[model samples]
Target: MEKKDGSIDRKYIPILVLLFMGAFIDGLDTTIVNVALPTMAMDFDVSMSNSTWIILGYVLGLAALLIPAGKACKNGRVKKFFIAGTLTLLIGSVVCGFSKEYAFMVVFRTVQGIGAAMMSAAMPSIIVRLLPPDKKGIGMAAMGGASGVALILGPTLGGFVVGVASWNWIFFINIPFGIVLVLLAMHCLPKDGVPDPSKDPTPLGAVSVFLTVGLLLVILQNYGDKDQGVELMIACSAGALVSLIVLIYSIKHDRERAIISTKMVLNRDYILLGSAFFLSTMMLTGTQYVMPYWLQISYGMSTMESGMFLTISSVAMLTIVFWVGKLVDRRGGRSSSIAAQLCRLVLCIVMIVITPPDGLLILAAAMVFLGFSQAFSGTGHTTRMIHHATPGYEDESTNFLLVINYAAAAMGAVVYSMIIAITLPETTLLEIADYTVRMTNDAVNFTAVAGIAFLVLALVLSILVPNRVPDKSGKASEASDAPDNASE
Candidate 1:
């Protein structure tokens, strides 16, 4: 399948649709679970701290498997990975829906995360390989749109579902969607031969990478908890350190023949783009972790109401992504990214100064602005990263960037959790068993710290992004191959 301009055939639209669906499910699952947390805690008879692991477990699972899954895709097994991932996610969701114990639910959610990691690493690479260069921005925008729609609707949808149905519906809802996605993917996704690219084809290295990421996350989550025993902390920390060393060694040993292709990380453009994505994830995910709690605890609002307010930000994000994509295509990525970061910095300042009771409206407005800022920064930075990826390294580059993004997100969640736990007194309860939860001054402080972090990231981004045009050689060459009448 080939295009007039030597790009992949346009018939890849069906595959793009599959990816869009996958992204929508991912976004929905992330936010939708928030509304169900308290209910889950009650059902499982766990403390709020332990219950938080419901979310943390999924994230940890994703971080652990992301790099390995990316490697798999780069080894020319993308279609197979997608099919396997979708089936796994479907089964996991079913298990989660039926889980009666906290431990069982956590395990199922981890499985779901593994599915997410596989699909996430494959989607962008598929788009890059299939779409024409000129349409790259639009293709990404469509992917972004699916995410935005899910984010916008997630809270409200979850709240309503929980209110009308049972919390279990949240997981069960994925069953049908997953089935359709898998079938569509099998039919639409292109087939490629799978060859062991690395000299060491044993699965031990992949297992080691997964364990390393998981251990580090566990340590990070438990680092500052005084309630945990000293022995636990020491053990977690030691495991994390060892895992880090092993991960480094594995990467070095497989640098050339590995599916991840270490050369992708060596590129200056990839480094800058990946770092920028990491910072953005730090800010965005951190804020997401805290915001729903703030709304529910501080404002005396219903879960559905809080979700509706959060949806406003998603609406703004969707609109801004399309606009930013066009700007990146026209003017290049660096300048657009710097501009977006500047906007975010200003918004963060506005967020920090406004106190809660008097500032709820101000916070809502800030969130809307933040949505736009994130879209601009994410779209521009990601486009630039893909533009600079070496030939045949597109899958590896996409995977590396996404892994960095998810890692940052996991760190952000852990940091936010620690801040909330530390700032709030032990006697202060954010929620109780079927009892009203009250907000304390500490909750306000947590949001303020998160806002400050965003400002810092924005400042760094403004300084780092270069002002230059994208190299259009690849696109130009593809265009020259087109028939004379095909020239627009």
Candidate 2:
């Protein structure tokens, strides 16, 4: 399926741009609302606890729809879904901009989340399908670059926007970008047909997946919370039981047609790769969730200041991802992965040892190490997962692995939050002037928990996973020393 001129078709460039645009907006929205949460609460007269629904609503919507959206993409309705999602996002943004009540804003935010889910699911598959196998790593890098840039810039941009203008402007900003993406996508994106229904539709299997994920989130949210009353505990337990039952039933009944694709799951390589991805993301995202709060509360810094400090990690990640990609292509998965995990372990220990009152400069340096660790591990994990995927199941394999990665992230966030909520009250430090010591203690405790989890997970993954590439002697091996072809 090589194109004319011995190059990937340039026709896909516009589509990539559109997908990148969507991802950028999604990133922007996440950070923009984060800085504006206090403002939103004050304006709407809601408690901080209630205002959190703005975030939870979006996550719930995304979790509910991600797998189904992937199914839809495989069924060849990608363009339709993309356009619909764009419009929905546009409308949701407008609704959010105009919302004066907390309930109304939460509902619209959920709508935006649905759009985000559809776009996220469809975009990667489209990228993979359009690019040649040889060029896929580069293509993935480009897409990943866009996402990385958004992550690096989002909080800073959000802080600036909110500081200088009204919070409403953040939502309004997406309108122009959304319109342009939709129009370009209509012209540039190809229309794919429906997937063959004769090949195991698995509608019921999909339902079981939805239920399982929902129950998992609920359990994570309630974990370690002191207010878990008898009814809440009973409900969580029941939910876990139901999830297990549905999962077993799905495995038994749809042994061949399960939504998670049992064939992929059964592979030893895929299982290990999935586990590695899950652990890597859990550590990366947990740190991301807590770091900014740590900077702001511990150092008495503003949102903008915190973001600036955090950018050091993003810069480090950006540089390492390129090198990591090359290593994955050349050196085989095992060596790169093991090295990355070891680096992460070192960096995590460094961060934990250098507690607050160590000054922002020292913290920033630690974050740089942390960021590099994340990039190296993340890139290795993703490359390994893709390289080990069964042929013709690239979409399913990649999407499934990504879902687990995100699920791990969600769980990590909840765990970190709960740890913070519980430990802050117990810390002996008195409240400091111009600093929120309680919140700072909470973040410190959360990071410690995440770091410990990462170390154990990395050790386990190192022992379990094998390399995807062959060695120099033409023998099958996990740690190849051959160099990658740079031309690709």
lDDT of 1 by residue, 1-488 (tens): 33567454567667658767988877777788876676677677754455667887777677777777777776687788787877877788888888888888888889988988877867876777776665566566667778888887788887788778888888877677788888888788889676575632236557776777776767666655556788887787788778667667767776664435566777765676677667767767766766665566566566678878888778888877877766665555666566566666555576557655678777778778777776776677667666667656776776766777777777777766666666654522434353323333355466556756765765575456454333333341111111241223
Q: List the residue pairs that clash in candidate 1.
A: none
> Cα lDDT for residue 374, model 1?
63
* Model 2 vs. true fold: TM: 0.84
Count of backbone clashes, every candidate in sequence: 0, 0
TM-score of each: 0.88, 0.84
The candidate that wins on lDDT is: 1
Judge candidate 1 at residue 87 and give its lDDT.
Answer: 81
Q: What is the lDDT of residue 446 in candidate 2?
A: 56
The digit string of per-residue lDDT tens for model 2 on 1-488 reads 22556454666667657756876776666656665554565577643333445665565556666766776777787788788888887888899888887788878887987887777677768756775554444445555555566667766675667667767777887788888888887887787786766444366666665566656666655555554567876786687678678766776776545566667778877787677767766676666666655666666667666666666766777886666655555565566666656666655666566656665566667677766765666566666677777766778776676577556656556566556645653221222222365557545665665766775776577557766652332223444444552222
**Stretches > 4 Å off in candidate 1:** 1-12, 45-49, 197-202, 390-392, 425-441, 467-488
